[model samples]
Target: MTYSGVVKVGGPADVHELTDLMISKVAVGPMHNNAYLLRCRATDEQLLIDAASEPRTLLNLIGESGVASVVTTHQHADHWGALAEIVDATGARTYAGRLDAEGIPVPTDVLVDDGDTITVGRVELTARHLVGHTPGSIALVYDDPHGHPHVFTGDCLFPGGVGNTHDDPEAFARLIDDVETKLFAQLPDETWVYPGHGNDTSLGAERPQLPEWRRRGW
Candidate 1:
């Protein structure tokens, strides 16, 4: 949770062009958790990811970004504690993966499964199921302005550190394998990985760790 940075989600620079889509991450709450705001530059539409453990802070971002949806990466409290705040702020539909969908603490507007596509203006989010951190954990992929793929990996993967898999030791092992086989292996080497709570890193940076992950697999 110590790492932090902001990639301009909507514009090339301060211009906030509203042309290419934007993806920004914010660290909030007592847990210093990571949440994301994704806005389509062309449409000025926005979505919030993992609204965990903070209302005021989350609402402030929602107000600032004009988000239209609140999506969950998992059901853990640190990942979804701010659901109520995000929903109230944007009147945005809320979504969660099937396993964790019912665990969102409130009713969800959409139940997302693997291979689902969520459209927000010009941006389309493809949900990929990577179950290891939890029974239901998913990540998102979308095309960036550079034509490179980007992922909003919430608690699923971090810069170099992984999430709290020890809580469910066996599941954590599978999570690591899933990352190497399903995530790191498939995404472009240069694909940008926006972790749930740390500085961004490219897939190339994470690729080398796959063998170690395989060894550590449960």
Candidate 2:
């Protein structure tokens, strides 16, 4: 019943309060990226998603937030670079899809794929395989009473455009199809989108721009 790379954060969500989402944006400002911590009040479990940049600083943030489980959307360094440090600092289990396994400095303890869910303290994150930008990329869905589900989109899908697929000749095209089918089709028009490298946005906000994206043709 025990797992590796998984540990406890001292702060409990109820005392910390989960209703507020208790999200602290680490490595923001000059770094200007997001590493979100979702604290569940009922169970006092914290889920850390994506290690933005600056591992030590991120750990400090994690300690402050009380994270329990950490999951990454992709294996790319920018996304996966801090895996070792964060894992070491907090002993939080690292989850990544099988395809992106090679990119992790140390192998991920939990291998997640499409439709699989990782339940931390009080949050349940469903995984969706979305390949294109990195041959192996995925998105995590966080469902709440809020208007729409929250998606952690790595380098795959952004606000206006998806991630660049420079390594793969057909990466851009595949990502377009991924956005249209896997993401947009299944998710509600108003689902919130948390991308790997930009400000927060939502599906409804990006709806109008889909046509423009299609026209640009990757």
Question: Quick one: best lDDT, which candidate?
Answer: 1
- Please list the residue runs of candidate 2 whose C-alpha ends up more than 4 Å from where it truly belongs after superposition: 1-21, 28-32, 64-66, 167-169
Query: What is the Cα-based TM-score of model 2?
Result: 0.83
Residues 121-201, model 1: lDDT tens digits: 778889888887777888988756567787888888887646667667677777886777777777888887877765678
Worst 10 residues of 1 by lDDT: 9-18
Model 1 C-alpha lDDT versus the unseen true structure: 0.73
In model 1, what are the clashing residue pairs, if there are any? 9-22, 9-23, 18-41, 173-218
Candidate 1 lands at a TM-score of 0.85
Could you tell me how far off, in angstroms, the CA of residue 107 lies in candidate 1 after the best superposition? 1.1
Candidate 1 local lDDT, residue 202: 79
Give Cα distance to truth, residue 204, candidate 1, Å.
0.5
Put down candidate 2 lDDT per residue, 84-127, tens digits, no spaces.
77877778888888888878777688888788988766567788
Judge candidate 2 against the unseen true structure and give its global Cα lDDT, from 0 to 1.
Answer: 0.70
